[model samples]
Structure formats: C-alpha cells, structure tokens
Target: MIRTLIFLASLFFINICSAEESKPVTLNVIKTSITVDGKKSEVYDIVQDNGQEGYEGVKGQNFDVLLKNKTNVPVAIHWHGLILPNNQDGVAYITQLPIPPGKSQHYFFPLVQSGTYWMHSHYKLFEQQLMSAPLIINNPNDLYPNYKSITVMLQDFSFTSPDKIFANLKKSSKEKMASMHMDHDMNMSEPDLNDVDYDAFLANRHTLSKPEIIQVSARQKIRLRVINASAATNFWVNTGKLEGALIAVDGNNIKPIKNHKFQVAIAQRLDILLSIPNKKGTYPILAQVEGTKKQTGILLVTPDTKIVLPSKLATSDAPALNDDQERQIHPLNSVVTKPVTKTLHYTLEGNMSDYVWTINKEIWPHVTPLKISKGDQVEMVYTNNSGMSHPMHLHGHVFQVTRIDGKPITNGPLHDTILVMPHSSKTIVFNADNPGIWPMHCHVLYHMEAGMMTTTNYTNYPAPSFYTKMISPQK
Candidate 1:
C-alpha cells in the first residue's frame, strides 16, 4: 500500500513539472512613442515582462506567445524566419484570424532551430509604424563565445501614414506611365526599384543625428547582428575604418569572409565579426540606403574618446547587389545527397504601373498553392520576370539556393529568404519535413499588400477550421 501511494505521488509530481514547462511567454503589442533626432513620433512596439524590449529563448524549448494587443486596430505577429508550426505563423487571414482591437491571442510552438530571427506585425502597414523587434534563439554551444554581441535593427521611418504613401505611389506611377505613352497593363514593363522616398533612416531606433553609442574596449572582438527591417529600402552596410568578416546572413552561419561592405535587402539579416583596433578611438558603422544620399548608423567608442557624428555619406549612384557574395556562403554542415522527387517553376510578375504584384500571373485569393508531400525533396525555380527585385520569403521552412540562372551551386547556404534579381532565375531545394499550409511571399511590405503572395501546402493535410472559415475557396 505504501509503494502504491509513492507511485501516485511521483505521477502527481510529474504532472506539476509538465505544467510549469508549458507556461507561455506573454508579449504585449503596444501603442507607444519614441523620440528620433530630437523629434517625437507615435509608433508601435512590442513589450514583454513588464515592458522589456525584446524576446529571447534557448534552443529546443517550447514558446507559447500570448500576444496582448493594446492598440485599437487588429494586429497579428509573424515569427519571421522561425520554422515553427503553421498555426503559429500569424498571417491574419491565412493562419488564424487577426487579434481584434484591444484583444489577445495565444500562439504556442516549439523552437526547433536556433539562430537570429525577428517578429513583426503581419497586418496591413502596421510593421511600418515600428512594430518589429528581434527574436533571438541561442544555442548552448555558441561558436563565438568570447565575442560580445550587438543587434542593429535597420528601419525606414516617415511621418506620413503607410496607406497614404502607397496610394500616392499608385497615383504617381499612373501619371508617369501616361506621360510616357505606356500601356496601363502591368505585364508590359518593369517596375522601378524604389517608389516612396522616406524622411529618415534609423539604426537601433535612432537616426544618424542621434545614433546609439556602444562602449567597447580596444582590441575587443565584436559580433554585430544587423537586421534590415525597412518596408521598401535596401541598404549597403559599411564598417568605416574597421575591416569586418562576414560570418552569417539571415541568421545562418557560413564560412567567414573578409569584406568592407555588404548589401542587406529588406527583411534580411547580416552577422559581421570585427576585431577592434588596439588604438583608442571612436568608429562609425554606417548603413547607407541604396540610390540615395540618406544614411543612418551607430558609433563604437572606447574609453576616453569623444564621440563625433560623421557627416552624411555620399554615393554617386545606387549600389547594386550581386550573387557573388551569396555564392561564397555555404552551409556549415555538409549537405547530404538526396534524390529530388519534385520540381516546381514559378514566375514573379509585377509592374509599378498598376501597383499589383502576382505569382505566376495570379493574385493570392485566385492563386494555386504549390503542393508537396511530407518527407519529399522539393526543388523550386523562381524566375523573376518583373523589373524590380523580389526578396521571396517562405514560412515554416529553410531552403538552399541550389542553382542560379541554370547553373548548379555546389554547397549553398540555407536561408528562409532569397532575393531574386530582375530578369534572373534562382532555384532552391529543400526537404518537406514539416507538414502544414505555409505562406510564401515577398518581404517587401507594399508589394505583399498588393498581392505578391502564395502558399505551400502538404498534400492531404487538413487545414485548421479557422483557416477554412476565414479564407474563401479561390476556385
């Protein structure tokens, strides 16, 4: 009888421990304001643990996200680059309904992978109001344990509302096409690189005029995680007077390469390692927007150094991005040779004349999903027929760029997002290990809002009831 009682006691203890492990992390989506360059502007931010700025967790742990909405409008949070379950992907209409105004929802998923990632509002235009933050997951065996780390989130801010800006862009594009005697059909011509001019660029929520200063000792090793969260801007990151080794892109580690400057497209991330000079002085790490004179950056200062803001950087023309650097990056682990079971071809089609973007000439509601079987090796070829670049991002999966323009890449780096250049083709390969419906779309905000999106689905897998009710059948 005593042994039976002890066994029951042990079972009770185990259940208690499980309950503790399954507790959720509460995050509040808030309406707030921050001062940039000495000017105040209203914005949105995510807060946790009594207003802590960001979220962090160790690898292999379960994350239950309780998103409390404090704003008056609906919002949903997308766990960018996280290979979580599809139900937690946070697309408003596709995954689940948007969190209504002043309401909350729970998103629970397991952290199956470890790396640098971020989260932002998936709702329309809310991410432009500064509704993003870093979502970093740490591995126990860190590669660079001795190096101090810093996160620089790059953004483009304007006083104008994002809706109005998009409307104006559509109007201007129509006018410009009419003046040039061009057809209104979007398929006839390519779109321009940038449509809207922003008022300011920011690094770590501060402008160049009021940059965030990092204190460091001379000869210290530093790891800088740079995230380009801009809605429509690409940036060329320059580490002034400091030679940096490019270690990772989009949170995936690669063989380190020495570089003075690198380009980061919208919704991308770059991890750079720098060995500070032995001499005591201040150095600026600048992110210059492509094609414009505007720039923003942060300063790394040593002891007894006076911080002096540098003048705005100048470029004669817009910087161009190439696959040369991307080609150099390879997976840290050797890829196993496997037979590809299926191949899919897609064309990115869009033009600024009508401000409508599509995948394979069909918008989201009318588009057909790319279907794959679980555990099958899949290869997808994206041919960018559009004029502007499209940084295509896939949810709940990481893919390797296996071919570019019909040539095979020996060992490419794994990424959740890849930028397909205008009129170029990119081929990516991945194993369909996770089963669910996932949205694949361009990371550019306006383009996505205009219908540059699609879904990947596992054959015969059932979607959630909420999704079925929310999204009407396209056919």
Candidate 2:
C-alpha cells in the first residue's frame, strides 16, 4: 500500500512539471502610434508581458506566442529566419488562419536554434507601418563577456497607403515603356528599381533629425546587430571611419572578415564588431538607401564628447550593390560535403508595368511546390531574368551559397537570404532535415504580394488543416 501511494505521488509530480514546461511567454500585438520626423503614423507593435516592445528567449526554450490582435482588421505574425515547425510558422492562409479582430491565438514552438531573429505582421502591407520588432534568442554559454551589444532595426516610412503606391508605380512604368519605344537612344543602363518614395528613413524608429545616441567608452569593443526590417527598401550600411569585422550573417557565425561597408537587402541581418577609437569623440554609422541620396544614421559618442550631427551627408552618392562583400564570408563550422540528390531550378520573372512577379511563371496557390524527401541534399538554383534584383529568402533552413552565375564559390557561408542580380543566377544547397512546408520567396514585400512566392514541401506529408480549409470550395 505504501509503494502504491509513492507511485501516485510521483505521477502527480510529473504532471506538475509538464504543466510548467508548457507555459508560454505572452506577446500582445497591438496598434500604437509614434511621431517620427514630425509625422504621426499608426503602427502595430509586439509587446511582451512586461509591457516592453522587445523580448528575448533562451536557445532551447519554448516560446508560447499569444498574438492578441487589438486592431479591427485580421493579423498574423511571421517569425523571420526561425526554424520552427510548419504549423507555428505564422503565415496567413498558408500555415494558419489570421487572428481576427480583438481575438487571440496561441503559437507554441520550441526555439531550436540560437540567433538574432525578428517577427513581423504577415498581413497585407501591415509590415510597412512598423509592425515588427527584434526577437532575439541568446546562447547562455557563448556570451561575450566584455563587449556591449546594440540592435539597429532600419526601416523606411511612407504616409501613403501601399496600394496607392503600387498603383502609381504601375502608371509610371507604363509611361516609361512608351517613352523608351519613342526614343531609341534612352540610356536604360541604370533602370529605376525601388517603387515607393519614402517620406523618411529611420534608424531604430527615429530619423537623423533626432537620432538615437549610443553611449560608449573609448577603446571599448562593441557588437552591432543590424537588421533591415524595411518592407521594400535596401541599404548600404557604412560604419564610418571605424574598421570592423563582419562576424555573422543571418544569425549564422562566419569566418570574420574586415569590411567598411556592406549591402543589407530586405529581411537580411548583419553582425559586425567594432573597436572604438582611443581618442574620445563621436562617430556616425549610416545606412544609405540604394540608388537614392536619402539616408538615416545613428551616433556613437563618448561620455565627455559633444554630439555633432553631419549636414548634407545624404546628398553624396553611396556605393552600388555587389557580391564582393558576400564572397568574403565563410561558415565557421564547415559543412560536410554531401552528394546532391535533387536539383530545383526556379526563374524569377517580373514586370513593373503590371506590378506582377512570379516564380517559374506561376504565382502562389497556383504554383507547383518543390518536393523532396527527408534527409535529401537539395540544390536550388534561382535565375533572375527580371530587370531588377531579387533577394531570395528561404524559410526554416539555412543554405550554403554554392554558385553564382554558373561559377562555383568555395567555402560559402550559410544564408537565409541571398541577392540575385538582374539577369544573373545564384545556386544554394541544403539538406532537407526539417520536415515541413516552408515558403521560399523574394524578400521584397510587394513582389511577394504580387505573386513571387512558392513553397518547399516534404513528400507525402499531409497538408495542415489550415491549408486544407483554404483550398476547399466556399459553401
């Protein structure tokens, strides 16, 4: 009788432990407004239970996301660059249904990897209004003891609606095409790329007019975690006059390489380490929008130094985007050479005249998914035949860049996003270890909205309930 009582007590204790392990960190998605550069615009931001806008989790903990939508419209959240389960991916209509107005949903997933990541709204154009924030997962054992870390989330803000901006772009593209035919000698060397003209560029939700100042000590080492959270803008990040080493890209550690400037496309992240100068002074770190003179920046100042904002800094031309910086990165831990079992070729086709984009001439929901078996090493080759560049992003996995335009790149670093130049091609290889349906699409928000999205599916896995319901005929 005593043994029976002891066994029952042990079972009760196990149940209590299980309950504790399953508890989730609550995150509320609410609408708020902040004035930036004299403009007050409404935004959707994710706030934690502590009433803070940002939150962090451990490497192996379960993050129970309670998405409480406060707005009148439906919303969904996508955890960018995270390798979670398929059902917890937070994609609207693909992974799960949208969280309705004044409702809540639970997103439970284990944090399988440790890195710098982010979460943003997956609804139409909601991400443009600053509905995103940093979701950092740290490694406790691998902490940098003496260095200070800072996160910079760069974005572009516009007062106009995204639908109207898209319409105007279509009209302008039609006019340009007609003019090109009439005037044969029109120099089309540098074609217009970006669609929308932003009212202001921001660094950490503030403009250069009132930039965020970082307090620093002379000769101290600083680690900057930079994320390009813009919906449709690319920037050239310049660490002005401070030589830094690029240590990681897209949350994966790389062989450190010294660089002064680097191109960060949409949805990309860069981890750079900087050594402050011994002489105390202020320094400006700038992110210049590609193909435009407008820019935004942040200042690092010592305790005794006075802040000096630079005038006419954005008028000067910034460097063009290229693969020179990408070629220098190599993964810290080398991936074992595996035999390729499958090869999928996708062509990125788009035209600004109609604002339509496609992958292999098909749009999402009508496109064929790239299928592979579990444990298969696959190669995805993206050929961009469009007039503009496309930063291709793959969810749920990091792939090594194997080739560029038919040339092999030795010891390429693992990346979640890689920029394919206009009329060029890029090749990446990854093992299909994570068994789930993953979206592989262009990082550009409008481009993906217009149609350039598809999925990678493991063979024979049943479609989730959300997807099955989406494809069912309306009653």
Residue 299 miss distance in model 2 (angstroms)? 1.7
Backbone clashes per model, in order?
Answer: 0, 0
What is the C-alpha local distance difference test score of each model? 0.84, 0.82
Q: Once superposed on the true structure, which residue ranges of model 1 sit more than 4 Å away at CA?
A: 1-23, 182-190, 334-336, 469-475
Sliding window of 10 residues with minimal summed lDDT for model 2: 466-475
Candidate that scores best on lDDT: 1
lDDT of 2 by residue, 1-475 (tens): 9999999999999999999767766788888887887888887788887887765888878777777887788988899888888788888878888999989998778787666778888778788888888888787765454568788889888888777776776678788878878999997654566777888888888888889899999998988888899988889988988987888888888878887887888898988889998998998888998887778978889898878886425767765577887788898764436988899999999765566788888866676687888889999999999878888988888789988898999988788888888899999999888888788888888888888888888898777876655432212
lDDT tens string, model 1, 140-185?
7788778888888999998899999889877887787676666555
The ten-residue window of minimal lDDT in model 1 covers: 183-192
Give candidate 1's error at residue 290 in angstroms. 1.7
